[model samples]
Target: MAYLRQVVKTQSIDIALINETHCGPRDTSTATDVKTILDAGEAVLTAGDWKAKDPHWNATKTSPRGTQLLHDADALAFEVIGPDVPTHYPDQTAWVPDTIDLVVYRGFPGRIALDVLVDEFLSDHQMVVAELSDSTPSTTPTQPRRTIDWSVFQTTLDAAPSLPTPSNAQEIDDTAVKLTSLIQNALTAATTTENPKIIEDRLPGRLMKLIAEKRTLRRQWQASRCPRQKADLNCLALKVRRALEDHAKTSWETTVDDATTDWVRLHRLCRSLNGPLKHHDGSYIYSASSRAELFADHLETQFQPNPAKDPMRARRIETAAEDLMRQRIPAEEDPIYISPSAVFRAARLQRAPGPDGIPNLALRHLSKRMLASNGRVPRHGKGLRQSLARRVTRESEDSGTTTEA
Candidate 1:
């Protein structure tokens, strides 16, 4: 059992099968022992698809074992997959080769593309090889982040045509589109696309070598079935398990320390470590879209205003703000204007690109004439949306300033 865990960890096996378990009617000792190992192993290893209280596991716990027919259905929703050929080969003591090996999986049926028996002569039983393919669909498509070279980006932008100044609302829209496109093109020319780095195993050479030795011992014990060989294998398995535990602890500590200052990184790391997300009903969230929807729903619920609180008070405050804006506005349309200095200051700030995808760096390096023109206020209800204009008007009224607007 310990050697089984070693194989799963070293090989990064997502699913495993154990054959020749020697569990049958009137004797479930071996099966019970395996379950015990699994109970403990899951803590240090990855969790299994089946739960402890699964109907199949509970029903078969102490029941007399019967031969599992090919058409037998699994109560726990696991599908049994078997090769068309025999897998077990008895030594000279028996002439017939029997099919005792089977694979049980609970996932998308199309995931496993092939299930074949391989004659490797490693043991009496031929190895069962299952090939899996990633055919599941994802909701959101991810784009690789472009790694921009600031110096190259600056040079590219400098070599491009001068930004055009806009005089009206239509021109403003066109100019924004053109500016965003130019920045995007410059970013493409001066950048390389690379996906985020994933963490890999960094186990020490000594530990890796020990794992290899353990594998060799496991194979030897399986072949010989000698008490001495078993003892040696057991001793080595204990050592390997302890070493793996220590290495895991150290790795976790290091990861936490490095991620301390970056909450986003820390959050991602924790999610990866915690296994798959489950729905409120206990089923696993498989599709990326499903997980995303679940999160969105949860956030929506959290941000919703409390029904128990005063709803009238909120409406009154909003009404007061709207009334004040109406009272302060002049009969004639006088638009708000952002000074050139203010625009320059805003463009100089280090921030992410807006919804238009225009980065601050692009705005900062744009021509002074274009910047001044862009800062000029458009006629009321022309350049900005009504809601945005109202917000700005109310803010200006509160500040006792109308020239800025």
Candidate 2:
């Protein structure tokens, strides 16, 4: 039994069949020993004794312990034959083959059989044979081809040219028009809408008015103060400028308080001034100080000092400024020239001047500026020369006259 289990392990067959042990039917000692061998080998066990009747053979439950043996040779034979057995073999009776008790059991697909019967009458002992069937279906179908309408296909081909091609100019124009309308409508809606709840109900508009008054006071203080105080005033002015720019760009629903907080800082600065600042045009400065002082303070803070103030720093600033200006201003001559016809068409379609001596046309304004500067605007000399030559040739032909060059 140990040798049979070793053979099953080494050979790798699915089921192990043991036959002709020559053991007593009543004792079950050989079956117990075989089961112990099978348990150690991790294989299922089924057994039969040729001497035993009725039950034939039965497979034991697979487990770590040895399988329980049974005396049932007939039952084991029925399991071996499965459902494909005929009622009788040749002229033999149903129970004629009593000596040939079969026992069959299944295991993992790779276990080898221990011993098997080969039919000595046919060849040697009874042999176990396995046959495999290729149950796959055929790929090709046994059918004829279906007809398609050639006229329908031809009609589709003929209709292809009539389909609309995409137009980029039309799409761009539509997008531009839509964007313009949307912006205009949004602006109009913003103007018409009431103030949001937070701004409208909370401060009673007094906080915003106070902030504006404070900013005015600060501007006045900055204008009146001496050169030392100018830097602080300038910083305040910059903050104000940024705030105003932000306010301008903001949506209408933005709160007045949120928009005007920078103004409050300017107001605090103005309150520090000695007196109200007066303007050159006789208007009072934002605070109590003369207009000249205010203007001087503004210049001191905003404008960089001349080279005389600090020669090296001034020179560096001047060079940087020159480079910046050069970059900002376009070249006098465009690298890509415009066609004369396009320019002429643009000039011709320009609007006329208004009643207030204001030239509504861009070309007329440019021409006026050019004339005032004593600059010569380009004219089509070639066209004029061509027209003159044509006129001379027409006159000479009509009069039948010729001149030698």
Candidate 3:
């Protein structure tokens, strides 16, 4: 009880129920145990269930524990919301499982969708699963991941305006970076797409379908009490059971296969299994070439040069030679360096291709080439940042020279 109290307090549990408590006739003080468990004060609600060992008492007046629960509910302002369904079904002969599971709601009254999963025979007592919600049940669609093309991103970076004129180098560089990002975004828009897996493959949908079918059959058999009808219903139930089992087995295998590191096969599998990227209007692009064209169109729209007569929005820092001294980083000093590390960090992994069909991974590989080129000081170079900028631009041009083996 102390342990449960600590757990509830730490985890902020609103409603808690205990099963198989064995709070029997010999137990001296139930108050101490209850207080120890629900010591979080009036914040949390708790409940326990008990059953009469002997068959002498009727069902309603069976256990003192149930009476205790009712007392607690009234005192603690808890609600015992239910349709009074039998929690435990009857077993073989006179041996019936006890309804020893107690449910309590801390907040306002609401219906609890509780159902016994008979197919899952966990123990002598059947497992009951409950979903707590204010509204009706919700069905969430399952989404499946698809592969992305990364190789084309580097190629796009190659064409994006890298070697801007050093006069106002900062503005030109910013424009170039934005343009590059827009193209990559467009590429990703084309290359990466998702398909929603049918809900029938997973969870309560399939299970519920089978359960409904089985129940319908059971009801029909109960109504008719005919041997031929019972046999047919039994066969259908067996078929549904087999299907459910097969779904569970295959779903596990599929998940395992997806987790494998075989990228090429996975890519091919995804492509084969899923459809192409959808347009802005939700129309699908069927072919890779079409996807590329769509990306190109988007890139043209997004990366188009600034509108004519757009304001520069810059104030001149120095008007006179005397005021020039106060200007930050004298115009003569080297322009601020954008490090190779920064560029590499910006190049995200598993990204889709750029407008030129080069991936971010491929662009990332060129960080070495940029660093190497920038290592040596050029004799004619005015500033370190400008020189590095030129080198990066040069590297972009040369990226197409060598093919990745």
Candidate 4:
């Protein structure tokens, strides 16, 4: 008992098993010895009649004769009890209620197992053996998988009508012309008639204002109602108006020429001015400062009746070009050069060089002329090279020159 207590306390073994204790009439002086062992504070379950040496008590108990002595012990906090089978001889055949016969120690509860009953039956003993079985919890039944009718969905989609195809460019231009004519006629009628009932009622003014306000909107509707082109048109109109206002403040004079030469000069000036020359397209010619210089040089050499006599006209063109170029290219950095060929391709691509197409060297010179300018060269080598190549191609094409490999 002392040794078992020591093992349980020091070795941390909460349960201990001692088989063949050999307690009997001759070995145990009195029943006090069994009681003394049990009262040591550990739980004890003994098999067979340890006080009887005849071995008949073990047989009568239906316990094996080999289990004439068996001791199961545990720590103070644990309890040991008989298995599901009855302990008394007469009750041995009676139905034994299912009971948890295992002795569990309090601390580290599942760590220790005495297995004394299991050991007794497994030994060479005439004991009735029973197997311990575990019961599993019952589970709920599962529902079946669901199916969908995709044909119904597809049929619903097929029943819907397709949207109308968008209107094209010719349709849009035609519409715009008709709307403009209507507005112009309304304005003329309102201005001309006596009493002008349309104006008296303010209908003509309202309608004209509405048309002006929605002219862009109408164009947008005709342009397939695309938001992107609507925005572009709005921006284009703003730029054109600004360019025209800027040009109106200048003293540039317009001169007429034969169709082909005029077209060539206009196209060249447009390239020099950066794209289509904005609102000045049908009016005055505007060129970058460098191109203006080239034109002046050309005029003096090829077309001057007398340089002294044409000085005033020459000054007017030069001054107008200079003013326009100044407004367009405000940056003080060296202007990047784009060749004439590049300008042609850009026109073909419907793209224009950024602001004025002011050549780098010319921009540098202009910057110095402006007095308040600071010059800086861009470090984009690849972009510069590409710009140069494009300009070369355009210039070559314009000059009717071809390259041979």
Candidate 5:
């Protein structure tokens, strides 16, 4: 079992098949022990005269100290992959052959290629070889990121034709599209020449080849009589292990940085991570188009002119403000101006675009223009569907001013 653990760790084996596991009876191991050493988010199967629980070899004599293998296997949800069969090799000396060898499974038999391996080395025992199914559907691994060449990007950007300052919105849109296309093309070209994740994330070719021969390397190191030879191989193993660890650490950091907590964040992080977007009415919006439409509909409702709320109170307030303005300037108080400062303070940084498809970035850059154009006082039943104008009234304890903001 100790040697088996060493193989699993060094070789990264997901599933294993062993004869005479003897997991049952007089043993006092926990579920955590089995799970930690072998199970990788999967089940494990055991059988025969010895398993995690005491084996019930119906034909053979029973031992006083039995195992809870039957109870444990049930608890772990492991299925008896194959029916009981004669696994122990033929014993010519015995009048009747005994069936003592066993085959244990972890997951379903679906992708597993099972076979009986008979050998004389174990005397009566035979090896049960099982090739478990590949967990990944594709043999190839997909990379969300790649090493980008800044030189290529810079060259591509420099080669792109500079557009004149956009005199109109259409020209601005066209320029944005062209720049986006150029940048995307450059990235695609740069990536094409680079090694993929499988190759890029691997150890150096020589080191990787050496790591692959770990079984032979281990055997040679163990048998070698020369201390110097053993030391040299040990040093090589350490270097290879260090390299692998560094690569794994880098990969984990990247994954963590790019991970998402919610569906919205996940979708924003990667377009491939689409999920249902629920509507305000308690239904789900599935498709991207549907989600966008629902969002736009909500924004349209907000953009629609809101009916006057507390009209009578507004009139009273307006009258009071007019009276205060007419009275005069107070000698001690400073009047505050109705400005865009409130809205600016309210704007959140790095926010996702609203239904209008405009991120805070574009709005912030054009904020001054938007604010400067605020002088056009909103007229009842006016030009645009709704107005951006907000009325602000600032006053001191002794003085007041009314401003249409």
Candidate 6:
């Protein structure tokens, strides 16, 4: 009782229950033992600082078995939440179990989602577990992962309508929206209905079931000591071992396939296997958005310029920019005339998709049609095009090379 009291106090348990306690035959003696375990004084009981309940405490109607509940008096309203099922078995070979134990809670009855007896058969008494919830269940459903076919994505993208030429800023905005929607729709259409084995390292369901059945059969054979049962258990054990070996081989092959076929999945699998990174305070950075925020904050703080610290250098840079703008420039040179090969190289260099979830390769194939109409710049972007042309001409002259219009 003293050890139990110390454990309760050390663990800060608000409620505790003891079953089949043979404290004493008399109510007065049992109450005295309860007081010692609860660490409650006469003054504390009078002030309602602690409360206890024992249904079989009377000396007149004495019984060997007794259950008691002790809790903080000021805590939430508690009572005996009962599943009314058998919890105790007499022996390992006993066919029937008896209900000689109960579970007690220190919170509202509504907080308990379930209370049940588990047939573990490890000991004479069955295990009792409760599921408690103070909040409502989440409404969002988990989305199953699916493989996307790149060929289908390309086909769908090619079938989409050609982008309209924009003459103004609103038309430019409208065109961007259309392209974004088209890309997203094509990606959706390309997604396969099949959800592959994402966690390849996990044991397959059939293998797990076989393993469990083998355990049960081994136990039964040990109890019965029958030669036929022993033979059956041995065969099951062999099957389980074979299933495990097959699963291991299949999992390794699947991991290799995923690493070669999908770079995104490979990256995710590597991160998962390596575990998550931690913040400065030793908390895990679990979500991608949180990690992005952390990186953004770090870069913002580390790279912020202190222009006042180097005033002379800042002035020299500004003067150089002004001088470069004042130099002589050609009238008709196209500054942003990017070659197809250069575009392809730039797109290929981007190994990961952008924040908008569009593949960088899409830009290489779609840029020419979207950026210009019939090989000419859109009307709204002509001013910027001329500005760039002047800049290029000035730079070309500075390099002692003439830019022909």
Each model's number of backbone clashes?
2, 33, 11, 10, 7, 0
In candidate 5, stretches whose alpha carbon ends up further than 4 angstroms from where it belongs are 1-145, 192-348, 351-405
lDDT (Cα, tens digit) per residue for candidate 4, span 1-405: 467457556865444433224443345333345445545434333333232211222222333322322322222333332333322221122433222222212222232222223111111222322222122112222334333233432333334332222144444345434433432333333332223222232223533443344344434445465777666556654654454444434313332243236878777655544533222123233468745765677678897555566888889988999998788556798889999998887774432344433234322222221212111111233345677799999998877754542
Q: State every prediction's TM-score relative to the real structure.
A: 0.38, 0.18, 0.28, 0.16, 0.23, 0.35
> Which candidate comes out best when scored by lDDT?
1
Estimate the lDDT of model 1.
0.57
Ranking by TM-score: 1, 6, 3, 5, 2, 4
**Tens digits of per-residue lDDT for model 3 on 193-282?**
678654633365767777666555655666667898778777776777677788779886886587576887677666555645666654
What TM-score does candidate 4 reach?
0.16
lDDT score, residue 323, model 6? 100
Off by over 4 Å in 3: 1-128, 131-164, 195-217, 225-359, 362-405
- What's the lDDT for residue 315 in model 5? 84
Clashing pairs in 4: 335-360, 339-391, 340-394, 340-395, 341-393, 341-394, 341-395, 342-390, 342-391, 342-394
Q: What is the C-alpha lDDT of each candidate?
A: 0.57, 0.40, 0.53, 0.39, 0.50, 0.55
Candidate 6 Cα errors over 4 Å, as ranges:
1-8, 12-146, 192-274, 280-282, 286-354, 361-405
Query: What is candidate 1's lDDT per residue for 121-183, written digit by digit as tens?
Result: 334556656555444322223467777677777677667776555555677777767766767
- lDDT per residue for candidate 2 within 362-390, as digits (tens), equals 22323232232212111223344567789
> Per-residue error at 88 for model 2, in Å?
12
Q: Lowest-scoring 10 consecutive residues by lDDT in candidate 5?
A: 372-381
Cα lDDT tens digits, model 6, 313-395, are 89998899999999988869667788999989788466476677776655454434543532333454676567778999988
